[model samples]
Target: MNRAVHAVRRHAVMAVGVLVLLYLFLPVAVVVAFSFNDAAGRFNFSWQGFTLDAWRHPCRVPGMCESVSTSLQVGAIATVAATILGTLLAFALARHQFRGRASTSLLVFLPMATPEVVMGASLLTLFVNVGVATGFATIVIAHILFTVSFVVVTVKARLAGFDSRLEEAAMDLYADEWQTFRRITLPLAAPGILSGALLAFALSFDDFIITNFNSGTTITFPMFVWGAAQRGVPPEVNVVGAAMFILALGCVGGAEVWRRVRAARR
Candidate 1:
């Protein structure tokens, strides 16, 4: 009777897990399905037919392609800048002890912890005070500010396991500090940095609210989607979103594979 009870419990646990997974993924699955939907006037899971016309008809919306291009440019530049700065900050926080360290850490994380609207409002105020005109540049700055926190946290976790003695021993062997860090610390931490960068890029690319507030007269993909939705989103917008989702998944999967490969080699 005890063995039968245990078996039943195991099955129950598995069933619950399966249900949770389905709940999470079902919406995404539905969206992808709708992207290929051929129904006119209304689209849903009940497939009226199948078509790829939506994917090919993005040109129907004026400035749609330009918005996508601008988003890519901003996300790429912001991610690069944020990753470099955040990785360096992570190294300093992990390796050095300094005054106001706690305060500094809190400040660094403020952007991530704060609500998007609040962050956006604050940035907008700062730009106005500084007389900085809003557009792609403002959006890039906001993206970097928010996304840097992710990079810092990720790289800091990797740094926790790092042995400073390796650098010390390298110094003992007549290697300079920079040389030791380049040869030892950097190689070990590269995977974490790379993963953080990919994550930052994904976040920046998908951002809508903060980008909307900071971007004045500059349109990104999310902005395009929002404006289109106000007029009832066309099927092609769904197609664009589906394509982005696939690309994002590919990037994340590639990062994970790279991380695993690095671990295996180590």
Candidate 2:
């Protein structure tokens, strides 16, 4: 009876997991299906018929490509800046015992815990008071600010499980500080760093609330999507969304395959 109960509980848990996944991905599946929609009206929500025109003319909508370009640039810059800063901060928090260490950690996580609207408003007010113009630079700054916390958290999780003995061994083998870090520490931390960077880029790329607050005249892809939604979303927007979903999936899949291959080789 106990074994049967245990088996039932396990099956129940698996069913719940599958249901949760379906709930999350159902919308994505709808979006992907609608990307090929040939709608007579501006709204692409209802599928009229399947056509390859949307994919062929992804930039058919005016300002669509431009917004995508702006988003890409901002995401790239913010990811690079946040990854570097967060990785260093994670290392410090993980390895060192300094004054106010607890306080510093709290501060690092505060941004992540803060509400997006509040953070956005605060940043907007600060920029206004500082006489800083709202544009691409402001958007990038805002993205970096929010994304840094995620990077720190992701990299810190990786660092938490890392073995410091490897670095110590490197040092014992006549490796200098820089050599030990470069050869031993960094290689182990590379997975975490890469994961953090990818996450930062995704956050920056998909962000709407913060970008809306900071971007005065600048339009990113999310902004463009919002504007289109107010009128009637273009099919091109769906195409872009579908393409982004596929690209992200491909990247994650490739990374998983690469990791398995490396493990097998080892």
Which one is best on lDDT?
2
User: Cα lDDT of all candidates, in order?
Assistant: 0.88, 0.93
lDDT of 1 by residue, 156-244 (tens): 99889778788889999999988997898899899889889988988998999999889999999999888877666666777778888
Q: What total of clashing residue pairs does each candidate reach? A: 0, 0
- Clash count for candidate 2 is 0
TM-score per prediction, in order, is 0.88, 0.95
* TM-score for predicted model 2 compared with the true structure: 0.95
TM-score of model 1 relative to the true fold?
0.88
Pairs of residues at least 3 apart in sequence or in different chains that clash in candidate 2: none
